[model samples]
Target: MPKFSRRRFRQAKTAPHRGFPPAAARSAAAFAALTLSACAVGPDFVPPPAPASAGYGKIGASTESAAAAGGASQRFAHGRDVPGEWWKLFHSKQISSLVAEAVANHPDIGAAEAALRQARETIEANSATFLPQATLGDSYTRQQVTTAQFGSLASSSSSSSSSTSSSSSSASTFVYGLHNANVSVSFSPDVFGKSWRTLESDTAAAEQKRFQLEATYLALTANVVTAAITDASYASQIKVTRDLIAAYRTQLDLLEKRFELGAVSQADVLSERAQLAQAQATLPPLEKARAQNRNLLMAYLGRFPNADKGEAVDLSGLRLPGELPVSLPSTLVRQRPDILASENQLHQASAEIGVATANMLPQFTLSATGGAQATNFTSLFSPQTMVYTLAAEASAKAFDAGSLFHTREAKVAAFEQAEAQYRSTVISAFQNVADSLQAVKHDAGTLRAQVAAEKAAAESLEIARAQYRAGSTTYSIVLNAEQTLLNARLARVRAQAARFADTAALLQSLGGGWWNRIDETPASQAKPTDIIATSPIAAAIRAQAEDARDGR
Candidate 1:
């Protein structure tokens, strides 16, 4: 062995025992840790109590129950409100079509749907905490280096000369390449229930979004129905105004004859003309309002506001069912989508308090990883080249100067704020139902009075025509009777429209006709509510709706 220099020499380190921690062993450790914290460090979640029955005002008995009592069970009974297809109660095909379009295409509704999708994706991402995360990777690298030492070694002479040559020799070049490929798996066991808490919070937030979607739908339908009713009313008023203009024109013609006969002053003719002008002016605003309402309906259908393609729905043609299909003391507040959404918000706030509280205690996580590495590509798959790591970490905010405490306190305040907001929403719903009920009743009475006045005016106009024909009354009396009849007819139209408007408002205040169904739709038959309630958290709230209906 005369000090021979080998062409190549390599050293490799292998961890033959390297692999993921034993599943049973790691599982046992995690179970032991979590079992010790059976009562999580944070405040355990407690759902907000259901809205109390007290303080709700009297708003007439529900007519929906009367309809149900008639042995109609195919549809929702008195307390059988469901979520999807709630608008079907209106029994208007146009309404159904418009709602379908809105759900599919309305920008706001589309945004809400996108938000729901993102929430589902977020749920999937968060689920990684409970499952292992895996990664597969490959790397390649090349590099060049200058080596003056190699150049000097080739020119070796005397030892001293060789040493000097090593210092002064031109640089030499070296090149090499490396490739590495590996697949790794990692996990951090949820020993402290932090992941569970996060899941709970996210679940609540997703539910809040769902209920918000429902609220938006409810509001949109309300706007559409109300606008349609208002438009019909204006159409009726326009007709009345046009008829009044005709009556005024006839009166003015007669008044001009009276002036030529020296029976009435020219002032009387001018007065008649002015009355005709007033009637003409009244028609414009009513026509404008009617057109505006049509535009609104188009907009609700997700079309251009001034779209001229569709036939305007006549309010008179729409017969609101004689009875409503809702309950008394109006669960409207409890069932309203906005209110339900707010309740979900309160829950999220409650869960957040738990999260912030958990931060006060030490958090423990059991982590594990497994992979393989080797300089030789062929050895990469060998057990000798495999690598594994198992670790347990304990962390805490050691010195945050009471930041955790303050955060927890802030979450507590937020929960209280949400609670107050929920209560306020309930109160507002009650007011709406009460006001709408009163409106319905008063509008009904007013319509009756208007009909009576119309009859009286018609009779008076007939008497005036007879008296003028007999030359016993001045033309002015005929003109006055015509004006009176015109006012009464327009008043009747206004009253009728008012009745429908109030009825629609009542329906809106009572959370429409769909809040009474108890059964949740399955995935196959799943509608909007089903899709929204897909999450366990949203399902829980929907279940609450059924429970409350059952007086639970």
Candidate 2:
């Protein structure tokens, strides 16, 4: 037989015997009933409206950030879509690699992924409530019975004869083995859509988990990038401080020679020595910060502090992104993970209201059992020994002291609470964007100012040193110039790093481009393991998790 025809034949042969009507007729009745009662109780969920504001901040705000060295003037292209791998915009291979590693190995990302999988599985388990449940079992029992128990004794009997009969009957007690087998099926129809409402709530919860997973991914990548930036900043600042110390030492030597030749006073030599000591003292703290940042980066990569495999990043290797994508306020709520997660919570709460409402209504269950019994195991399936039963049950709360009503009211309140939280999330998402935008703008101006100050200070120090060497100016003048120049260089390095970090912040605030991600699975049925190896990022994490599980 053809495959299609064979499947139809099998379905027909095993069709349920509902004992009331044909399966087709029962199905039609069920469909009609469902159509008539299709409306779910409680308020349907509607997404919160987007904010009315046009821009993240004041209207007509400048879109172009201030210009600084290294072409740090970033232009915000409104409505531009962000890429999934926003860190690549900095053009730093080391940072890109670190972020990739962090995404793959971070335990927090693994936890979030597991949570999303768990939620999906819960939804699957809950959905089974809509289907009929069946069970099968077999049993054998040995039992004994007495004829006297049935009152079969004659009334006109002598005591000795009756006692003799009773003794013989007790000695010959009837014992037999019985065998039984049965199949039972039960189903609770979703007449009021309670089961469906529960399923909906579970689906919404899974969606919330998916968004949380996305948020975790975003946070992990952002932290990795920021940590790399900080590490580079500290490295550059340490080098700058060390070089300034060397220059101070050289100036101290020149002062000592001049003091020996009576060309400068001993006080000048002591001042230069003190400045050199101050410059050297700055090294330990910067080194400490660098060490801390390295350890942090190692942690982000899911490794121990002593097991740092990450390469060092330098500020010179990073290029500031020229164009920045700024999502509109209207779209921010939809794109941000936290906002979307909150929306799912509101949806789950809405479904909970329906579930609670259904709980207050009547519930119906239909069940059927068929079996065979016999005194001997060989005759268990005989037609004469067959038995069957069919039943229907319904229950409703006639009076619950208003508990059901109050419970439903509580669900409504929870729904309202979720709605408020969703609104708050949207508002906070927009505020984050605003703060990042302002930081990017102001940090650019700060960098530009620092660059100018560093330049002027460098020129002043060079001129002062030349005058001191030519015996035309006091050593004090050169010492002050060197101190000013060192401070200026350190400030410049900070400003440069701030520009990069804030640019990353702006991208993160704009939702981290989750929409651009290619590895997203269907939220309802996907498991963390199903997609854990689907992308490079997830693959890395899965490999680490496996290694950890094996105690490698």
Which candidate leads the pack in TM-score?
Answer: 2
Model 1: lDDT of residue 165: 57
Candidate 1 per-residue lDDT, tens place, 96-147, comes to 6665665555676667666766766675566456555677777767768777
lDDT of 2 by residue, 1-552 (tens): 001121221111111111212332244333332343344454444455566753577523333343444435677788899987898898988888888788778888878878987876776566456567899979999999866654445323535776667645643469998898999999888777676567667766777888888888888889999999999899999999988888888778877887899988888889988999989999999999999999988999999998976588888878887788888777787678898789779778877877887888789999999999999987886799999999999999999999987887787778767877776777778778888988888777788788889889999999998998787998889888988999999999998888889989999989888677554333322332232312222222233333433454
Which candidate ranks first by lDDT, i.e. highest? Answer: 2
Clash pairs (backbone) in predicted model 2? 104-541
TM-score of 1: 0.76
lDDT of candidates 1 onward, in order: 0.60, 0.73
Worst 10 residues of 1 by lDDT: 8-17
